[model samples]
Every structure is written in C-alpha cells, then in structure tokens.
Target chain A: MSHDHDHDNELDPFAARVRALETILTQKGLIDPAAIDVIVDTYETKIGPRNGAKVVAKAWVDPDFATWLKRDATAAIGSLGYTGRQGEHMQAVFNAADTHNLVVCTLCSCYPWSVLGLPPVWYKAPPYRSRAVIDPRGVLEEFGLTLPATTKIRVWDSTAELRYLVVPMRPKGTEDWSEERLADLVTRDAMIGTGLARVPA
Target chain B: MNRREANSHAAMLPAGVDAPVFAEPWQATAFAMTVALHDKGLFSWSEWADALSAEVKRPGAASDGHDYYEHWLAALEKLLSAKGVAGKGDVDALAAAWERAAHATPHGKPVLLQNDPSPTEGRGGRIG
Candidate 1:
C-alpha cells in the first residue's frame, strides 16, 4: 500500500542531520553518546506538551496560584515538579484588558519546552521571531485582536537562560469553570503571550 | 508529476523537506503560540511577518533547515559571548564534552525528534 511507502518518507530530516552530526562528533572524539542519549530521552519522553498544559490548568482554577505564577513562573511551575532543561528558569506575564503582553526569542529558538513542548516552526520562523519585538501591536492585530489605545503593551525577548509564558486573561463567564475546562481555553499562543484564552460558547 | 503522484512523492521526503508536509507538529505549535498571542492583543501579524521577512533578507541568510539551525546556534553563541557566560574556551570544552558523549553511546538505537507525536509510539499521552 502507498501508506507504507509514505511513512518512510516521513523520517525527520532534522533527526537525520542531528544523527549525522552525532556520528561525526563521535568519530572525532568530540561528544559522548551517553550525553546525546540523555538529551534524547529527556526531551523525547519526559518533558512536553502535557507539562505546559498542567501549568495552564492549575492557573485557571486557582487565582492565587495564577498570581504567583505571573510573579515568578519558575517557582510556580517548579512547584508542580515540571523543571528541567529549556524550562530551568521561566517567567509568566499576564495580559489583561488594560495591558498586553507578547514574547519572542529574537536570537535563537530558545523556548520553555518543558512547559510548551518543542517550539512550533513559525515560532522558529524568521518572521515572528524578528518582528514580534519591533512592532508588537501590528502583529497582534493580524491575529484578530485589537487593543484599546490606552492599554499598555509589554514585549519580552526570550533568552537562552530564561523563557517567558503569557498568562492570558480569563475569558468572561468562566468564573465557575474547572481547571481542565479552563485549560482547554488556553491555546499555545496564549501561553506564549500572543493571545488570550477563548471563552467557551 | 500527477497530483496524487506528486503528493505521494512529496510525502516520501522528510518533513520540512517537502513543501507539502513542510511544517512539523512542533513548528505548528510555535506558529499557534504566535497566533494565540496575537489574538490576545500581543502583536499584529503583519508586523511579525515583515520583521521575519527582513531577517530572511539579511546578508548571508540561511537557505535550508541545516543552515537555519546553524544560524540559530551562531546567534546563541553571540548572545552567550556578549553575556560573558562562557569564553571561547568554555564553548570548546562543552562541544568536546558533547562529542565524547555522542561517541560513547551505542549505535542502532534511534534518535527520535523531540516532538514526534505518533500514537503507536505511546506519545499520545495527556495533552497538557
């Protein structure tokens, strides 16, 4: 069946390149296989989207927790036992009716993978990364959000050591919602300071 | 190639290699994050797109995924260098350490991508 053939073609080129680099570095006595194994195991199995979701879920149900998360996200996130590479130091910014927040890793694709999983391609793309910090208001408009002129805007540039998450303002009429239900409203962009969680219909 | 044949052929290449399936799930996740932030009044899409296009047009811009990663690594190095986090010697030492680890491990075992979400692989776990 064509399906079988189609699957083989799906092998990741990025994986292939990483493997090839590993082979070369190993042959040259540059890197140890054990370290690569540790990296692979940690990122592939231990940390991912689930971790990110957990943080969002907790914040939705607990206001104090959410406040703490915004003040010091690394501590709040660590309280849930989701600390590791790419998420060692984290921060959360809150976006509200009077203020807007956005995040960009202007340098490299440094992200809170332990919380958000691997960054999306567009996050790693040249467009969002470079423009986010320069003209955030315009970018926000493209996503279908238009803020009032009186609202203050804050843009964060993520670095290798610290990653930022955006705590989107809770959608209206969700006062009695459960954590899981509220979390469902948290989209990946909402976590990254691009959008707000949507209110359920 | 016929439409189906072309799609089949394109499907055979690794993701991001084929224009059709060019975006990996992780890439989509990042894009969604950007979109979400924009939707929440973080930034406009046009501003972000324009900035990214400018970055692409920069002199000696990368042409492929490999080049892109390399560029990213270089940018990281520059940031570290600026911060005095590590001198050239420190970077060399880390690279040496990574090489040692890579070589010591056994072959045959696959190096899985960080965001491969296949169900058969037991990856379809809790979403959050």
Candidate 2:
C-alpha cells in the first residue's frame, strides 16, 4: 500500500491566510496583484545590492563622493537613485585598516532594503542578530571572513530611524579599474559587512 | 525534518549557501503586498516599521527566525486593520473561505476566490 498525503486537505494556515489577505485586498480594489508582481520582480532583478555596489565603487574611485557619502549618505546614495522604504536615512561606514564594520538589527531586521534589496535569512535570524553584536569577529569567521587581529570590529545596530551601509576597502591591484569593474567585486555580503569585497585574481 | 529529508535539503543548497531568501512563496507575496500597500500610500515606511518591529519583538517570538515572515504577515494584517482597511475578523473569515476554496478546487486547477464552496455574502465581487 502507498501512503500519499493529500495536499489539499493539509492547507498551510499561513499560506491560506496570505492568500485570503490578497483576495480581500483585491476584491476591495485596494491593490492590483499585478502591481505586487511588478514590485517583486523589480526587487528580484533591478533593486538590490548591485545598487549598493555602484555606490561603493563610486566611493572607491571618487574621493569627493566618498567624503559626501560619509557626511550625508542619504543624499549621496539617493543621488545615485537608490532611495525608498527602509532607507530613508543612511550612513556609510567605511572599513579601514584599523576598523571593520558589521551591521545588525537587534531590535528587528531594519535592513537597507532600497540598496540591499532584501535582507538575507541569516540577517534576520536570531542567532546572527544576538551574536553579531556580542561576537562580531566570531560571526565573521563563520562566514569565512577573517580580519587582521589588530583591526577593531565595530558593529552597527540598525533601527527604524537609520540604516547602515558598509563601504569595504577596495582590493589592491584595481588602481585603474573602472567603477563598473569595481562594482562587480562588491558582493552583498561585503556591503552588509559579513564578508569583504572580492579581490580580482 | 527527518534525517533523509534533511540530507535532501542540504543537497539542494550549493556550497556556502545557507538558505533560500524565502523558504516559501507566500513569504514573498506577503513581502510584495507590504511594499505594494506602502506604494499605494496606505502607510508610511516608519509606520510599517513600527508595526513590524512590534511583531518581531513580541515576547516568545520564534528564535530561529523561520517564523519571521509570519510576523511580517501579522504586521501587515495589523496595519491594514489599524488603517480601517481590513479588520482581523474579516481577514480570518476570508482565510476560512480560502481554505474551503482550496479543498473545493479540483486538482490541477487554480484555487480562486470564486471556488469557495460557501462564498460569503458581499465577497463575491472581485476583479479577476
């Protein structure tokens, strides 16, 4: 005898609830489901860490933009057109020889979504949230990132009021590299401070 | 999950990859709905944040973060009700309707609101 579970009989409460909510909203003409699809597609394809990468690469090559980013990250990042919810206020923390920056939201997952698209599952996980602050170096080590022993680790706790973007140090041997080339080296993990920018081989 | 299922799951993930961005599709839809509602000017980002933060910080919330999007959906529901959009009772009722609709829906067919066996009064008028 074969034991096959009936999928229809075992409807997930959460999925049902979500579908019900969508249906209700649609019936009320509050939201077009197509619009939701477009937003999802935009985040999946267009708006993401690549936008942050552009900002990082620009900062890498342009000293003035770097200064501007440090002074007013909101305007600096907005000037590049990566502005939206969860990113109303921005601060660019530059990772340097003496200091490394890591971002976490202990209160909640207050990620810079406009620049970073969506926060990774681990970013919102309790272990990373509670441990990133208490053991920043240890968390980095788990991600296979090891900073120099002398480098100080600074953890930024994101809140509803402000979000942080880490400006990782530009890897060596890219002196004459274009901003586009530099952007390619900026990974999502690097912007979030879990890992460093890739060093072109 | 059982050991065999866990191994299959691990096999699916590439090296160094932790987990999928969303464990399920509803999570993505819930996320998109929140953004779409905000785009419709239903609430400010700060207001949305306050609702979500409240849900996330609620006592005894899931520690593994697997239920993070559940909180997210709850926040959206709370915000919608607070804005006088859809009340809690309405959402619960509709969810029950969808549950019926899913069971009523024939296999291999889309589960639509119209498929609800006992479609509640005044809820039948929907756009597509």
True contacts kept of each: 0.00, 0.44
| TM-score for each predicted model, relative to the true structure | 0.58, 0.86
Interface RMSD of 2: 6.6
Q: Write the per-residue lDDT of candidate 2 for residues A1-201, one digit (tens) a residue.
A: 112555654347888888878987887788898988887778767787889999999999999999999999999999998886643699999999899999999877888888888887668867777888988887787776778899999999998779999999999999999999999999888899988888886
Candidate 2: where are CA atoms >4 Å away?
A1-11, B1-18, B120-128
Tens digits of per-residue lDDT for model 2 on B6-109?
23222211222345566777888899998878877888878988898889888776656778999999999989998898888777777877777788888768
* Stretch of 10 with least lDDT, candidate 2 chain B: B7-16
Q: Is the docking of candidate 1 incorrect, acceptable, medium or high quality?
A: incorrect
Whole-model Cα lDDT of every candidate shown, in order: 0.55, 0.81
Tens digits of per-residue lDDT, candidate 1, B1-128, equal: 12322232122112241132113332222233333333444344344444344444466754233345434334333333444543444444333333333343345443233233332232112111
- The TM-score of predicted model 2 comes to 0.86
A125-144 per-residue lDDT for model 1 (tens digits): 56566667877877666555
Per-candidate DockQ values are 0.04, 0.34
Interface root mean square deviation for model 1, in Å? Answer: 12.5
Clashes of each: 40, 0
Model 1, residue B47: C-alpha shift (Å): 30
